[model samples]
Target: MPTIVVDVMPKAELLDPQGKAVAGALTRLGHEGFAAVRIGKRFELTVDAADEATLATVRQIAAEILSNSVIEDVVGIEVVE
Candidate 1:
């Protein structure tokens, strides 16, 4: 079996309150290495096979189901063993 990983991120123009909160916490904890942080989502889907047809279907699922088109973008989709 193979696992498909889908990465989704909020649109660049939108504000990510969760990310901001994390960044603030990092700063307060003396972690100055990170200038900013943007939170995103990752979905792992297990499949029997990693074929072209399956990949296409996964892409469609990533775009239409896993993420909101208005606020989030499907950044990446990859197959992992």
Candidate 2:
């Protein structure tokens, strides 16, 4: 089986409270080199085959369920070993 990966992240203009909170915590914990953090979601789905058609279907699924177009962007989709 192969895994299809979907990465979802908030748009650059949108505010990410969770990411901001994490960044603040990182600074407090003495990892202060980072200026900002934007948390994102990755979804993995295993399929019987890794083909172009399967990839297309996974793209549709990610667009419909894995990400919110209003605020989040579907960065990319990949087939992982």
Candidate 3:
């Protein structure tokens, strides 16, 4: 089986409260080397094959179903071993 990985992230302009909270926690825990943190989503899809057609469909699915176009962007789509 092959796996398709989809990475989705909120638009840079939008504020991510969850990410903010995590960043705050990191700072409190003495991790000051990091300036900020932004959380995103990763979707792993298992398939029989990783052909071009399947990849196209996965791209569509990532844009339409896996993420919110209004606020998030499909950052990446790739086949994994």
Candidate 4:
């Protein structure tokens, strides 16, 4: 089986209030040295094939459904055997 991994993250120019809140909580909990935090999404899909055609389709799906291109980006894609 092949597993497709996709990571979606907010664009640098976009505001991530959730991320900021998490960062603030971390700081309140005494965690330090981190400059900032940005929340994102990851999807792990097990598929029959990890070929280029499948990847292309997945990319299109990501672009269309998984991310808001105006404020987010599909940051990573990988196929794991």
Give per-candidate clash totals: 0, 0, 0, 0
- Writing each residue's lDDT as its tens digit, candidate 3 over 1-81 gives 999999999999999999999999999998888778899999999999999999999999998999999999999998999
State every prediction's TM-score relative to the real structure: 0.96, 0.95, 0.97, 0.93
lDDT of 1 at 56: 98
The positional error of residue 17 in candidate 1, measured at the CA in angstroms, is: 0.4
Is 1 or 4 the stronger prediction by TM-score?
1
- In order, candidate lDDTs are 0.96, 0.92, 0.95, 0.93
lDDT of 1 by residue, 1-81 (tens): 799999999999999999999999999999898987999999999998999999999999999999999999999999998
Please identify model 2 stretches exceeding 4 Å from their true place: none
On the 0 to 100 scale, the lDDT of residue 33 in model 4 is: 94
Q: Which order, best to worst by lDDT?
A: 1, 3, 4, 2
Per-residue alpha-carbon lDDT of candidate 4 for residues 1-81, written as tens digits (9 for 90 to 100): 899999999999988999999999999999999889999999998999998999999999889998989999999988878
Query: Which number leads on lDDT?
Result: 1
| Model 2 weakest lDDT span, ten residues long | 59-68
Tens-digit lDDT track of model 2 for 1-81: 899888999999999999999999999999968999999999889999999999989889888888889999999898899
Q: What local lDDT score does residue 6 receive in model 4, on the 0 to 100 scale? A: 91
Task: Looking at model 1, report the run of 10 residues with the lowest lDDT sum.
Answer: 28-37
